[model samples]
Target: MQDAGFVWNAEELDAFIESPRKHVRGTNMSYPGERRPEKRAAIIEYLTQLSTAD
Candidate 1:
């Protein structure tokens, strides 16, 4: 899945990590309206750092 340019939202990401088939519906070629993992991960990591900093 990572080989192709597939993006995932928060809910989508959660669902995907848990079960790719269940969450991923419709088109297999593309993930309808989703954010990139790198972007999402960066945001999450940043938030974690901020929380820890506080």
Candidate 2:
């Protein structure tokens, strides 16, 4: 939960993966989130591993 209002947690990640524009309006990004649910899961898993690494 880095952001005050929005926490980058699993639930939020699911929503974001579903649709980047819907998740955050007027978003500025070169490429939007993955269209495939499985791919999104992989990316999230990788991120979690990195985040938890000490």
Candidate 2 per-residue C-alpha lDDT over 1-54 given as tens digits, one digit per residue, 9 for 90 to 100: 233259789878877877777787767644567788888888889989999999
For each candidate, C-alpha RMSD in Å? 10.2, 2.7
> Model 2, 6: alpha-carbon shift in Å?
1.7
For model 1, the superposed segments whose C-alpha errors exceed 4 Å read 1-34
Q: Find the 10 residues in a row with the least total lDDT in model 1.
A: 26-35
User: Which ranges of candidate 2 are over 4 A from the true structure?
Assistant: 1-4
lDDT for each of the candidates?
0.53, 0.75
